[model samples]
Target: MMGRTRMIGGLTAIMMILAMCAGCGIGGDGAHDAVQKLMDAVVAGDVSGVKNLYTLSVEPKMPTILTGAKLKQPIQNVTVGESEKVSDSERTVPVSYSLNGKKTAGSFKVKQDADKNWVIQNPPVFGQVSFDPDLTIGGKPSTKDNKFALPIGVYEVNMVSDVLEGSWTVPVKASSGFDYQGITANKNRKKIKLTDKIKTYNGSMSSLIDSFNLLPMCRKLKELYLNGDDFAFISGKSISSACKYQTTDIQIKVTDYTPDGDRDGYYPIKFDATVKMIAPVFTDSGENDDVWTCQSVQGGRQCAKFVEQSFELKDWDGLVSQSNGNVYYRLADPDQNVGELADVIYAGHGVD
Candidate 1:
């Protein structure tokens, strides 16, 4: 009976030892091995290998951003330390590696998947990010300190801030060891004042109108004057040559300026303006049938028969401008008919 009890006790002790050994192997060594593989893949620039080692949750979220991103300098002398078990299926492993001949240490959290294979739980963080809370990353609000532990990838940063009253969008590339200062410190960020924006819009208005060939209103009036009972007397070409539209004394009074709530760098302004369009009519002088009527003026001739119109325009919107000097305005609204200039007019309105 004693011999049988001893044998049973020995078997139980052996089983317990084997179970503990198995647990240690999978929980500790497995995580360290996985990290080592990851380091190797990174050094070799094997993106596929690196991606395969990531946990399922992290792999898909970062693949596009990680594509084509490689370190400028290869990581060398990578040593993965022993894994500290967090749970039955998780471990935290410390790693040291030389980059640019400088040694650095970091930690990686790893977890076991259903297959009991260790994988990286967190995506590799690439940069030290500090930015204003008002700025958004990938349309999500940033934290106060803005230390974004984002995976290696490119992200669109919206620099529109209520505090700064600035609006712009910029591309931020998150790469290994990148330091992203807030948009306020970014050299590429552009912010234009409301006064400058208004000035730019007003200054480019005439050219904007002319480029769109919106003088057809004046042309139509000339066509009406030239029409006679015996078929239309003026040819299309003749009407074009005889009538010209001139804009002067442009005055704009902005009644309200509203910044776009959703999009940065877009403003809808409501304003009233008095714009003068002078359409000169040329007719044959009684003295000479072939000569058009004209009176000498300062530096130019004043047509004897001409139409002068002063337009009191009001409630205009969809005037969009960027700090890069790009100005876009909607001219297609039926209420604001300047004659098919364009559905939208794009002009460069750089502040002087």
Candidate 2:
């Protein structure tokens, strides 16, 4: 009877030990399955499925920025290796897959949630990547905390600030750790000088200036000046009857070139321009024909009366292209300060 009791006790102990081992095995297998499911979801582009597999502790709710994100290379032939137990509820599972016809290996940190369901702790993704509030990733605004996330791929990062603005591309890899050092605006930027040769959409600066017709602008200003409220009381003194205006000898010399504060591929230019304005005096002939003739002034008829005006002009809001040390002027808002002049000379000749 004693031997039989001893045997029964040994059997009970063995059974208990087997039960505990089985529980551990189940936990490890569950973690492995969870990792496999995550890769499957990524391959299928199932965002919701991917979200469901992440650990509950993840912040910002997995970041919707990954909604349309994609892997640089589609994963194929995924093989989930054995899970290394970390604790009763946590495990690390090794995973291997084919990417772009090449074998790639990675791991997933998995743990059980409150309900004992396996979920990924360290997902093979990037998230909570911080940047300036005016920065954008892949052309989309960042989430709260100036953070964003993306799948394993290359992305275009851009930032707009008062100090500087620029764009660059970055690669986000799986399980590489989120050590993004943020973005810098100095990439691909080069300092330019006013003497640097520049090309515009129309052509060279000289050609662009040559194409501009200053007669219309001059005439409009002269008309406005002559028809001012001070002269409103003057009758039969139309612009055509008073003085004829003409523009000649227009020239431009660029003084400075500056980049836009908020964007790349844009520049503001300042220049000095000299133009000759001629106003020929006209007198009414005392005949019913109403013909007008040039009148003598200062003992000289058809007086070679002309005013050479020098103007300071700037196009501070222009789009200029820079490539391989060559600059191209795109478009700009001409800002000229020709105070009290008959007309304003537009900088860049309104090169839009």
Task: Estimate, for each residue in 137-174, the C-alpha lDDT of model 1 and write its tens digit.
Answer: 54555543445543332345555432224444433333
- Stretches off by above 4 angstroms in model 1 are 1-19, 22-28, 56-63, 69-71, 98-104, 125-293, 298-352
* Backbone clashes in model 1, listed as residue pairs: none
- Candidate 1, residue 230: the lDDT equals 16
Superposed by TM-score, candidate 2 places the C-alpha of residue 351 at a distance from the truth, in angstroms, of 30
Candidate 2: tens digits of C-alpha lDDT, residues 23-70: 255353788888878888766756677777785454435443446644
- Each prediction's TM-score versus the true structure: 0.37, 0.41
Give the count of colliding residue pairs in each prediction.
Answer: 0, 0
Model 1: worst 10 consecutive residues (lDDT sum): 343-352
